[model samples]
Target: MVAKRRQFITDSILLASSAVAFPHVAGAAQSKRIKIGQIGTAHAHASGKMSAIRSLPEIFEVVGIVEPDKERRKKAESAAAYQGLTFLEQDQLLNTPGLAAVAVETEIEQLTPTAIQCLKAGMHVHVDKPAGTTMTECHALHDEATRQGKTVQMGYMLRYNPAFELLFQVIRDGWLGNLTELSGTMGKYANDATRKQLAAFPGGGMFELACHLIDAMVTVLGKPDQVTPYAFRSHPEKDTFADNQLATFHYPNLVATIRCNHIDPFGGPRRAFEVAGEAGLFQIQPLEPGKVRLGLTQPHGPFKKGFQNVPVRKTTGRYDDEFRDLAKIARGEKELAWDSKHDLAVHEAVLLASGMPIN
Candidate 1:
């Protein structure tokens, strides 16, 4: 049985690897190509998401892109991803014939409102992160999607990371007897230009970065019973952005600590998450490559009782699997794993962590 269980671990690893591009999704070759239009290119991930969508010609038909800002549109249209795509007015693109989905990749301020527009137009939307400035905005976007029977796939980049996927498995299958601790740090250096942009919001680095960690934390331990936030300014004289930030989430059994900062000149490689429970511990460092270190208290499944590095497939593109899943959902092949309820929970946690008002 140990032999079988050991091999099962290998099979599990393969399962996650295959989901990178959804290369192994059943009937993908026959997937009804969902006509998808993109709105705006101001968000950082806008072009990347469009690139991923266009790469999957078998799954998504690029109906057109809508960017009202002439400067941004002209700048974006020249990009390789938008080179051959059409540019339409917002209403024109939203009302395109047979349009089934819209990727709401507008600016952070417009993310929720634009997604709400698409939802009210009877379209499923793949919205980029932070949801918006207010809990009310986030709730309205999701509430409209629910009323319209459409899906709202938020752009939480790490949802499909192989190591994080394994973490989900560990939590779900009781590999960890009971999740007791979850902690992560997400940071990146922001230049003057970026800092100026982010300084508009008090959440600062936490809102811009740690939302991803909060998404993962909420997955491991649902809505935090209480969220305690510590927001500080690393460069007080330069900007009002809360560049240095930490939020501790309290749950019935798990306490999750999340930190996000914009002053780490070398923080990218330091991005990491650690979790511990009664039975084992799992850690992923440099989350991009998803290097996994797992320790089991006793022999559990394929993992032996000591700390060891496990091979996890690295992602080719951060948003590839996400758009792939969006297509599958539009084609009625599957449902969103993180639904509205969960997203609302994550959003509320984000607001609390950033010390933004939920009301």
Candidate 2:
């Protein structure tokens, strides 16, 4: 009888242990997955982002890819980046079982529309850069997302950049007191073929490239009272090339410039922006985060000094940071940053700058 009692107690303890273990085992399986879908391979940056999604097994599961263009699909498959991934039809990709979100890396013209479809279908969206050609499209898309209670994170990857974060803090802290002048350059080396391709694009360089700087400018200076755009087609007779262009924005107490061109050479360093105020100046170099240099007037000094490097909190590549942030928001860890309202403002800027009629 004593031996029987001992066996019963041992069995009860073992059952209790298993009860505890089962939840963890189940949780491990749950935590191992984040069903991510890629909904286009039209953007130049798509492959890089796709590869990153594939490599991070603990955080993501590349459930499917949606490729509309056969050429692009072939290229994606040939590229080592998409070796083991399955490409699905658009409808199938959108309706995939347990699909959490879709990355809209389509052509610039298709970005806003495709994103709208994804969000309407109860999936979160990760749109590529220069969200849309016109602001109205962006606004309509974001409004629908708001109504659906879904997220639409625009592809302004640099905002997640660490240096820009510090710059934001400094600007807000008045470290650069009463910012007066802001200037940014969006330029890159372009061959004949690239230039021709860009020339075919309307609004030329401003819409295609300068949007980044313009967005950043709006971020730093708020909405401007008046905008005087200086668009020029430098090689008008040669091709539909609006190579050199500028947008001069006038704010309450600030003036900003956006310079865009395809006149630079390859392998050359690209310049981002310089914000100057009465107290100090901040410079952000392209593709390098946490490299913000701030130049402040000594508490009491007459001499003008050069910029001194300021400490910027480091952040990892945007693909990881953005996804992690979105996941955290989804998991009730924090609030979403690029909310519907914020996206509306961004879209408004894109439209206003594009000279598109705002609705």
Pick by TM-score: which candidate is best?
Answer: 1
Q: Model 1 scores what on Cα lDDT?
A: 0.84
Q: What does candidate 2's lDDT look like per residue over 121-198, in tens digits? A: 888888887767666787778788888787777767665566665566566555667677999877777677877877
Error of 2 at 3 (Å): 76
Please count the clashing residue pairs in each candidate, in the order shown: 0, 1
lDDT of each: 0.84, 0.68
The list of candidate 1 runs beyond 4 A from truth reads 1-25
Question: Where does the lowest 10-residue lDDT sum fall in candidate 2?
Answer: 12-21
Off by over 4 Å in 2: 1-32, 266-268, 287-290, 298-306, 311-318, 351-359
lDDT of 2 at 270: 73
